[model samples]
Target chain A: MTLLKVEGLRSGYGEVQVLQGLDLTVDAGEIVVVLGANGAGKTTTLRALSGMIPAKGSVQFDGAEVIGRKPEDLVRRGIAHVPQGRGTFPELTVDENLQVGGFTQSAADTAADAERWYEVFPRLAERRDQLAGSMSGGEQQMLAIARALMSRPRLLLLDEPSLGLAPLITRDVFERITEVNQELGTTVLVVEQNANLALKIADRGYVLATGSIVASGTAEELSSDDSVRRAYLGV
Target chain B: MQLFVQRVFDGLQAGAIYAILALAIVIVFRASGMLNIAQGEIAMFTTFIAWNLFDVGLPWWASSVASLVIGFLVGAVLYRLLIVRLGGGHASPLAVVMVTIGLFLMLNDGAAVIWGTTAKPVPRIFGTGRVEIFGAGVAVQVLGLLAVLGVLVVVFGLLFQRTKLGLALRAVTSNQESAALAGIKVTTVLMIGWGLAGAIGSVAGSFTASGNFAVDRNMMQIVLIYAFAAATLGGFDSPLGAVLGGLIIGLVSELVVGYVAIVGPDLRLLPGFALVIIVLLVRPQGMFGSPKVVRA
Candidate 1:
């Protein structure tokens, strides 16, 4: 039932260790969110999983070992990552940004895929030709997610999707995450600092401290747990 | 009046050479963010190779074409083996740049060892002809200049506009870390960018050979200064700007040398360098680059 498995993962920039023995997983058709504060290795965990950093661990996606593989190859294996800050290709049009997501797809096939995603996100469709940078933070985030989906990945990695947006925009992005989950059955792995909202939507969740997971449980259990409520969810 | 038009046309033909080298500089800059002071040196090295191949019984066309292929491989392999390692994050910025400057010397001296130092004749690709229009005579070389410029436009336009490779290269330029996250290979694309530009460098070298009508080891470095002026004048990443800037510098240089008899050929370098300073002073973004707004 597990689609991704991370075990004993350790990684870092030059001399600083950010992730040490990080273990986590996302089951098939599940939305698993990793909740943490800044410098808790949340982003580093995502980066390590995506193979952007040097790491010592095992990351198995759909039964294939992916720890040291190139990031582009990870996407080819049906794992799409929408990085933090919504790293949209600013100079390129919304549609062109989406096309970059589908880099591995045949040009002929991608043209067809674009029309389909346009139907799913109408605002993106309307602004298909507009530059990504001209849009609001929320819209750029939407485009980044839509762009990643263009690759038709089985597992979608959403890194800090709600970071730096207004509450309305945050709610909208969260709403869209559930929509994408229901509509496409995308197995989503989200990393967030907004524990309450993330836990509300995530079927299951993990808590990371520094670089290791301290806890894991169903959303309902984590919401009511004393430590979880005090440390995160700010209740 | 006829004399003025003729001077402009000849200036444009020469400007066309600067534009080619300038564009090569822009390509390498976009890929690695290095100014590549050695661009001209690499071109000169390859042009000498073409000349040697020609002397050894390869047809003029074969030798030139062969040089382009060799140039591409050399540019790519050189980057993979030397430049990229030096370009790694830990390397000092000045050290990397000075290494390229060192390459200029090594390639310059190296060429003499392989092909000797004397200048050589390159048989014309278009033969000889002249077309008169707008009160001026345009040699086939001038038309040939237009042809080469047109080819660069078409090729690079398609490269940045339509291909996945172009997308990957641009992505590498903007953010190498995020680009790696997206599964793009930074090293491969960087090498290709160098190789593609290297091949283009040979194209420019061939143009300088045939249009300028002689090729030599010293040619690329001299023209390199003008190409740098053009590249800097247009901003480092602006390909169209480099070409237009080159033509303007070329025309200005010719006008300065011709109309100002007191400043004749000996002082020709003055105007080109002056234009760069003026452009930099007026619009630091160069003539065509959009100002980048860096956010925290």
Candidate 2:
């Protein structure tokens, strides 16, 4: 089932176009990764899709047109975006952060979801009272992902989950993402520069360059591709 | 000792008024991340609205409540019509500050134009009465004002810490983009924040009028300065800090004026401002504000 279908997506900051005519699709219950180098419009693509920025494109989520919708409106349609740099409310406590994530849920559902996410990330559970800013990079990443899930989103958009984590920590984070996808059947569309690690867990992948998808294939095919290995996988 | 007790009661009464006004300033600051230079003028304007309502034979309490509703709508409308057009928090800080200054002049002059420049007598909300505490005679109005301040503090505290609206507010303050992504209506929340501040300003205005026994265009000017010092002393971010800062400023000013022969009643504001300067020099974040933390 095609959950999100985005075509000819164009977006940018004032007078500076970054994402130019991009197209992508994410199926239900699959982990899709968009691999790109720095400034390849990876973040812009996610921003446009999540309605964080103005974009001229057709975004069909669950067969409903979602272009020009605000971020809050999109969230109601079961889309959650965990933005770059974790986007956790630094001054807020971990528990409060989760509560804010459940902004659309009822009080009972919010409480239950908090417990469920806490159980998934015990480190967050231990430091539930601690400020989100005080947590380490890896823990903050886990909390960010958990916070996104608290909305009970059907489609999760993650931007550089491995951005600032140690190699071991990055592996751990990817494992958790895989677990979330398998257990909850949530569709994930993640943008990453860490092609090697991302492809390992991604079911299908696209290589984005200068706001366009240059190459795309199933995870196994892309990992074995010549140009993809030379550019992204570094050999 | 009796004189000291009298001064303490007097200082607390003044402090309660300043605390309420300071809380209004703090709420707007937290919501928009900009100091509203016109908060006092907004209060002054709303107080005039209350006066007009009372002039037309409405009960004093009913007049005050109606003014609060009007103030809230004014605040919300101002945000929707003006602030949002300027890009809200996305605008340059200087631009927002300038706009607020413009509002200050406009509201003050606008009130004078509408209500005339003369001060109008307003009936005390608590009525003319006196109470004796520790051999000091205090007006019943003073104690009532203090009680109102107490209730406002408790109610605001619970609203921020317990309610979902409070959670949404905190989230919006921390990060507007992420708050929207969480399905929280960022613009609506901001409007509510401004409306809350406006409603709070109306309370401060009514209380100030009740304490002074009159309402006028310039009634909130000096009060605003004192409230600023209080907010500065308490740290702009912490509500409790604002209240404590108000009381402390009030007490210090009252005592300095009473005890020091050199600094007479004419220099009552001197001590409050001096204390603010000292607090700023020693602890820039105020007494309770959390210092900006950046993780490496």
Candidate 3:
């Protein structure tokens, strides 16, 4: 089942068009990654899809045309976006951060889902009372992902989860993303500059450059492609 | 000793009002990240509404309640009609501050235009009476004001700490983008925050008028200054800090004016403002504010 479908997605900051007619799709139970360098509109794509920016596009989620909807309305439709730079509420406690993630859920469901995510990410559980900002980068990233999961979304959009973490921590984060995909069957569309780690967990990959997908294939195909290896894999 | 105790009581009475107004200031700042220069004038405007209601034979308490509701609507409307159009969180800080200053002048003069210039006498909400606390004869109205302030603090604390709306508010304050992604209506929460501040200002205004035994156009100007000093000392972002800062400022100012011969009643505001300057110099984040923590 196609959980998310985007076509002709035109978006940008005021007067500077970054995403020029971009197109993408994510099946209901697959992990898809969008690989890009800096200024490739990876962040812009997610922002436009999540309704954070005004965009001219057709974003079909669960077969419903949902372009121009507010971010809050999109969340109600089971689309959660973990913004770039790990958009955790820094001043709030870990528990409070999770609570905020469950803004659309009922009180009972929020508590239950929070507990479920805490189990999945034990580090977040250990530092439940501590401020999110005070946590290490790796832990903050985990909390950001966990906070997004608290919404119980069918489709999750992650923007550069490895942007600031150490290489080892980045690998660990990717492993967890794989585990989440297999365990919960949640569709993930993550944009990343760390193409090597992103492709490892990504079932399929799209190479985004200059605002649109220039190359896309199975992870194995992209890893073996000559130009992809030269530019992204560094092999 | 008795004189000292009496002075303490008097300081607390004044402090309670400042504390309420400071809380109002903190509430708006937390939600919008902009200091509302018109907060005091909004209080003044609402107090005039309460005064008019009382003049027309409504009970004093009833009039105050009606004005508070009106104040809430006024605050919400201002946010929707004016602040949102100015780009709200996206607007530059200087632009928003200037708008609030404009609001301050407009509200102040608007009240006078509507109510006329003459000061009208208002009966104290808590009837005039005397109570003794450790041999200090304190007005019952003062005690009542203190009680009201106490209740306001407890309720606001609970609202901020326990409720979903409170969590939404904290989330919005921390990051508007993330809050929206969390499915929280950022604009709605911002509007509620402004409304809550406006409603709180009404309480502060009513108390100020009741304490002075009169309502006039200039009623909240001095109170607003003292409240700003309190917020500055308490930290702009901390609500509890605002309350404690207000009481401490009130107490220090009263004590200084009473004891220092040279710094008489005329210099009552000097000590409080001096303390604010000291706090700003020593700890710019104030007593309870978390220092900005940016991870490299």
Candidate 4:
């Protein structure tokens, strides 16, 4: 039932090695969080797995070894990555952005998915004709998530969904992620610096530091861990 | 008044040709984010193909169609074999520009080697006949060129606005990484963009050859400059803007030649280009291009 399994995921930008022998796994229909501070290789891990960056590692997704594949190939294989900074096509209308996300699907299927996502995010439906760049920060974040979901991916990879949003908006984003996990039973592997909110929604968690996993346990255990509390929660 | 109308007609005919060429430039710019310096040379090469096809017993119309197909294939193949290696993004604008310059020289020389340096007269597709409008006589060729331009506009407008492939191309234009994440094949889109530009260039080249009465190795050299001015003036990002820009630049250049004593005949291109410089100085993004915004 392992949807994604990674072992010794070694990757970096150039000579500077960021991810050194990192390992992680996510079972089907589970919400797993990779919690870390800045420079923890959290984003790098997603980048490598999605083939945006080259890496030497064993990344098995859906029982297939997917190392050295292109990002588009990985996307068609149902691994959708909503990168940090909410990379939305600013000039395109909301509908066009969603259409781009559903590029792999058939016309009818893409349309159906559009309707489904719109029902889930009514604000998106209301502004479907508006340019994505003109939308508010929180609305843009929601559109990014919805755009990623348009592919109907088996596994969703979110990188810092709460990066630049207000506290209330961040809460709304987390709640939506939870709804996606529970309602559709889609597996999620989210990486975030907001340890408190991420761990709350995460079924299991892994703590990363300087490109390596330092500690990992169930969400409850990581929340109660003395070191995690001192460092991340400040409790 | 009749003389003025005649001059305007001549300008429009010239403008239509520039618009087609500018459209080619804009298509490639949208997908690749860099100007294809070889664009004019590619069109020149395709013109030779059309002339050769006519020599081999094909009708002029059939030859023109063949040129379009061949031009598209050549452009796509060139991108796969050469441009793809340069890599995209704003990282190395200089590299792309240089590679295209190299391509321009190679194509220019290649055409000469194959077709020889002598200019050959091209049979007018619309035939050499005169038609009068509002007491001003115009060549049938001028009207034909306008008709072709109109069709090109309608076809391209629909292609960009209504198709799934168009959406994918737009996505690739905005952000390659994000487009790939959306399951779009970025390279494939780039190839299509180049191929479409090539097809358009062939059309423009064919019209230019027939309009000017001949095709040669340097047939597109001066026309390319005008097209560049048109693209830059209209906003490189907007296709409609290219057409309008072409028409305006063409009209202005012609009017300057006809009316201005100081500019004279040889320096007519000067005024049009100077205007482009002024427009760019005022709006660096071009007239219709979106201003770059820095996000927080």
lDDT of 1 by residue, B1-296 (tens): 88898989888977888898898889888766776778888888888888888878887767778878988987898788887678553346577689888888999889888777678887776667888878677788788767878888788989987789998887777666656655677888888988988888887788788765677878777788889888888887888898888889999999889898887799999988888899899999899976763332
Each candidate structure's count of clashing pairs: 2, 0, 0, 0
- lDDT per residue (tens digit) for residues A170-218 in model 4: 9999999999999999899999888889989999999988888888899
On residues A1-235, what C-alpha lDDT tens digit does candidate 1 reach at each position? 8899999999999899988898888998999999888888888888887777778879999998888987878888988888999578776678888777777788887898888878877889999988777888888888888878878888988899999889888998899889889988999999999888899899999988888888889998888899876875456
Which residue pairs clash in candidate 2?
none
lDDT of 2 by residue, B156-272 (tens): 999999999988888888888888899988888888888888888888899889888899788898999999989999999988999999999999999899999999988788999
lDDT for B147 (candidate 1): 85
Candidate 2 TM-score for chain A: 0.98
> Per-residue lDDT for B1-296 in model 3, tens only?
88999999889988989999999999999887988888999999999999989999998878888988988988889988889899976667688889999999999888878988889899889898998878888889988888989999999999999988999999999989999999999889999999999999999999999888899889898999999889889998999999999999999999999999999988788999999898889999997776866565
A109-216 per-residue lDDT for model 3 (tens digits): 999998888888899999999999989999999999988888989999999999889999989888888888899998999998887788889999999888988899
DockQ of 4: 0.69
Which residue pairs show collisions in model 3?
Answer: none
Can you give the lDDT of residue A192 in candidate 2?
94
User: What are the DockQ scores of the candidates, in order?
Assistant: 0.40, 0.81, 0.82, 0.69
CAPRI accuracy category, model 2? high
Q: Write the per-residue lDDT of candidate 4 for residues B1-296, one digit (tens) a residue.
A: 77888999899988888889999999999887888999999999998989998888987778888999988997888877777887744337688889999999999999878988898788887888998888899989889888888898898889888998888888888878899899888888889899999999998889888887788889798889899999999999999889988998989988989998998988978978988999999998788877743245
Better of 1 and 4 by TM-score: 4
As a TM-score, model 3 comes out at 0.98
